[model samples]
Target: MALNLFSRKQAEAPPAIEAATLRSDRFRLERQSDWQRLESIVTALEKNRPGRIADDDLLELPVLYRKAASSLAVARETSLDAATLAYLESLVRRAWFQVYGPRTGFLRWLRSFFGGGWSAAVRDLWLDICIALAVMVAGTLVGWLLVAGDNEWYYRLVPDSMAGGRHPGASPEMLAQSLEGTEGAEGLTVFAASLFSNNSGVCILAFALGFAFGIPTLLLLVHNMAMLGAMLWLFHQGGLGFDFAAWLSVHGTTELFAILLAGAAGLHIGRSMAFPGELSIMDAAAASGRRAAVVMVGCVLMLVIAGLLEGYARQLVQTSEARLTIGLVMLAFWLAYFLLMPRRAMGAKVDPA
Candidate 1:
């Protein structure tokens, strides 16, 4: 009777062993539902459709992401089934990005940057801007006076290629023709690209050289303004001062403004680094760099716009009055955009509601 009872018990033990579950299987099954829910929400969010995700899911994103991350760690440690491990790894990665990775699209970022970020940065450098502007004005006057006191100074101040025969000795017809824009010039696309590249290079250099205590930046501003003044004096001598002014105004306003911004940005960084005050030099430079970067970006944009005007509008718009009007209008638009546009942090989004 005892041997028969023992045989029956042994037979029941085999059946119980056959019904047992593996550790990996049990682990996966217990959390599969949560993983599925997390994946669905992640997929919905990935589409970037504004209203597709429910409010509850949005609120739950961090929690879901954390749970999946924890699950992945456990799976790696326990050597779970290959399929389960792979699935969790992928799910965790995608969920992590959705939770913490960059969310702003290019267009949205651009709108925020141009809308207020650039202007606010510029405004913060107002003192630097004033100093730069004063230096430029002084440089211009110095060039003009130097040339006026001695015509020989004109040759030294202005490059021959840039002068394009518009020296003091040139007749009014020759000087006026130079201001006639590229009306007769060929390959305007090439001309515009070249002009843009040259201007951007100067602006970029001015910005980069600010680390040298801004002395290079100041010198660059002086050099640029001196050329302008020399040319202005030359045109004035030719009796076409208004025509020359109009031609320059069309593109010069934008171009010069861009230069001013670039110079100020350089000065801002240099000043901050020099007089860190309470902050360390590195911290001051980093803070100033952020602001200067915004100004430099806008400076490049302004250069592009100036290039377009120099290439097309300056040539197409014939009348002096028209040129003046357009230049002044663009100046006004830039001023209003910088001073009056809606203000916000650099990359902050508007409330969708």
Candidate 2:
């Protein structure tokens, strides 16, 4: 009689819930609702399959997952049965795996760690160096114009301290005598340390001057260039061009490269200030600093290596041609590696910072 009454009342009993409902449970289960909802979703999804999902529809999985998740929570809280819980668990797991579990291994790790915009960072660094080089060339031209034909240009520009009392461009015997005086281990140590300290100090100054928006960097570049040009002219004046070139090139190649790198770093900072792009001046400065730091670290390493080469090899090597060849080769190697190597292989690795 009750069955007949319920059947008859269904026609009059407001439609049963359109969605399934479960009884409330006193105890909470970890992810239990989620698991149940997942299964229910998959079943419903399979029933309503509209062929292959389009790419745009795939992107909506996150939203679908959330909806399933909410419904599952409601079911779990209201005492969903064991079967329901298991189904929800399966659903959540499959969804999660589909979303995140495909890519794995060293390549994935590499992509995550080094995938940021490092190529652009390194390119900007190279650009900064190129601009600095242009500035350096301008300075060189200015110096040449100032004293191009003057006989005393060399005397005025070359510092006495730089030549180590070897004259502006000493003869073979004079060069030999200078080397003989500093050949001992003690003298070598002193000479090496002094040169290292001086060169390193110059590099530091070049880097630090970036705080002034490149004016200081430009000034220092001009000063150094004028001094160098003057010294070269002096060697020519003294008819010791070959000897001086060999002597200076022995280590100057490395030393000068280091200085140029430092100057480039400074210019990078200044350029960031001068042209902030989408960033504020402060933001650009910070970005530039990070890039500059990489170059500066490389520069310091070069300086130390240059110091070692200059200290021991420059003095001991008597043959001018040999020293010149070695110096040129070292310079070429550094230039090719830093200036010509692919960006991805160079500074575009992980932690561009």
Candidate 3:
């Protein structure tokens, strides 16, 4: 083609194509299984072909990233490595970061946590409570079957020491002396409250451990359950069964319930990993972790309140009727506020008061 001297010839730069990164340089497949996994992911992604990153798509990244990483390794070792494959790896990573990376603000975190207030927590807690009841029923039935029929199995579910019964070897006077010796009159209330409060914290730790290590959290729960079972069994065996039940009812209603909540939280974390649904294990865990922290914090506050009641009020009062009455009141309050209120009164409204 000839251009006339008066005509301006248009010169256009070639259209820019984004440089493709070579994943082979960064990752290599060490196993055949990894290669197979990558193939599966790539095939699935190509099949589904969502145009852009959405929450639904973001949820799937954990599974995709793991698959792609494994595949990348295999591709590096085999003939599968290429520019297009590298592009796919970058997309998987981008999706991964979207699910887990920190968001913009405090409100974002709060919304992530408790946009629904105690309602969500209570929903989770109720599920846990149902499980706890099942465990208690099973444990109680087993205890009754093992121990003499004369022994009340409820005592086997809750111990005398926790319920406020005398030790077998130690006389009432001796236990009284021991209780008195644990703290001075000046600080005894505070000490007992703090002690019960922190003891409840062990449940929180057990629940939190599910995040770091999945099913192992159950071991912590079982341990606590065993302690409760053993104590109840021993008290019933000692003929102080009724008294023990009455005693535990005071603070045990709250403290033991908190432990159940903890166990539920731990179980939630464990199950998130076990059955991650569309999410990868890591992403599922991260999402579960946010909800779990909120629950665990609530558990801690319950423990503190229980500790104050157990230490200062429960131990010192020593009047079975009074203790039972007070325990019932606190239990009623919790049930009303946490369980009932969330359902009936508190919906989407956030209380500024």
Candidate 4:
């Protein structure tokens, strides 16, 4: 009797296992169509390309996503096969990202960046800016003293290509004529193009070389300031210092500020890398890069304005008083925009990376 009972129980075990397998198979077959539909919708949304989905699919996406989430919950409770549970969980997670992830249009991003992002970034890098300015000022003082001691030092500091016929030996009359645009239309065009190109290169280099501990950026700033000082000294010897000052001021205000900002951006990155504090070096660097990039974009825009002023206003606006007025007005406008503009609270949400 015991042996017969054992045989019967063993025979019943196979049918019970078969029944459980059939039930799971039925469950999967019943839900497979919905799962596939949900997956297709999610894939389309994830890719973010236009025209891959139909209008009805768009409407059905949220509905199907919810259904998938429900199915996942039911699967977990009922102890469905691991493979089916995993697919549902992954599909739901992906759909969740599409539904709730950061969403900013390009125009909105531009508005936010120009409206407040750039100024905020500049404000945050105040220490770096002051350091950069100090370096430039120190360079200027050195160049001026060097040139005063020896006229030949001007040649060493100021390249001939950059000097553009204005040097220590240039007569006052020649300096005045040069300022009056006696160089003709073609010459003015060429001069403006050359100036913009040269300055742009310097600005780019200052920002690009910050990764090397900011040493190169400092040197570039000093070199730029030295050239300015040498040029100023040259004009002073020719008794045209005031005139040259006014001429340069028209665009130099904007141009110099842009270059300084670029240097500050580079210095920010270098500082973050060197002194990462509690954060990992990579994390700190990434945060600093984002902030610096905002400032650099504004720097480029400033350079464009400077180029326009130099190319057009400096050439045509002959009177020193008019040029000074334009320069001062522009300086004031930029100062107000950057320093006085209303800002959001520090805790307010900012744009996502």
- By TM-score, the better pick of 2 and 4 is 4
Best candidate, lDDT: 1
Distance from true location, Cα of 60 in model 2, Å: 15
Each prediction's TM-score against the native?
0.72, 0.60, 0.55, 0.72
lDDT of 4 by residue, 105-195 (tens): 7787777776777788888899999999999899888888899999899989988877778777778888788787333455566667777
lDDT of each: 0.82, 0.66, 0.58, 0.80
User: Model 2, range 1-353, lDDT digits (tens) per residue?
Assistant: 22233234333434353122213132223444443444444444456553555555556666667665565677677655444455455565666544444334667644532343233333567776777778777766665655567745655665667656544445656654553323444477677888889999988998899878988987898788877766565555556667777888889899988888899889889888998999999989887897787677677778988988888888777788878997999899776665454454222333221
**Candidate 1 Cα misplacement greater than 4 A, ranges:** 1-101, 182-186, 348-353
Q: Candidate 1's error at 273, in angstroms?
A: 0.8
What does candidate 4 score on TM?
0.72
lDDT of 1 by residue, 1-353 (tens): 22234334434554444333256556866887788888888888788663887898889888988899899999889776556677788888898777776567789879878878778888889999999999999989988888888989889988887788878888888878777755554677777888888889988888888888788999988988888888889888888778888888888889889989999999999999999999999889888887899889899989999998888888888889999998998899888988887775676322211
Cand. 3 Cα-lDDT:
0.58
Q: Total clashing residue pairs per candidate? A: 0, 7, 12, 0
Better of 3 and 4 by lDDT: 4
Model 3 per-residue lDDT tens digits across residues 211-245: 76545665566555655555566556656555666
RMSD of each: 9.0, 12.2, 12.6, 10.4
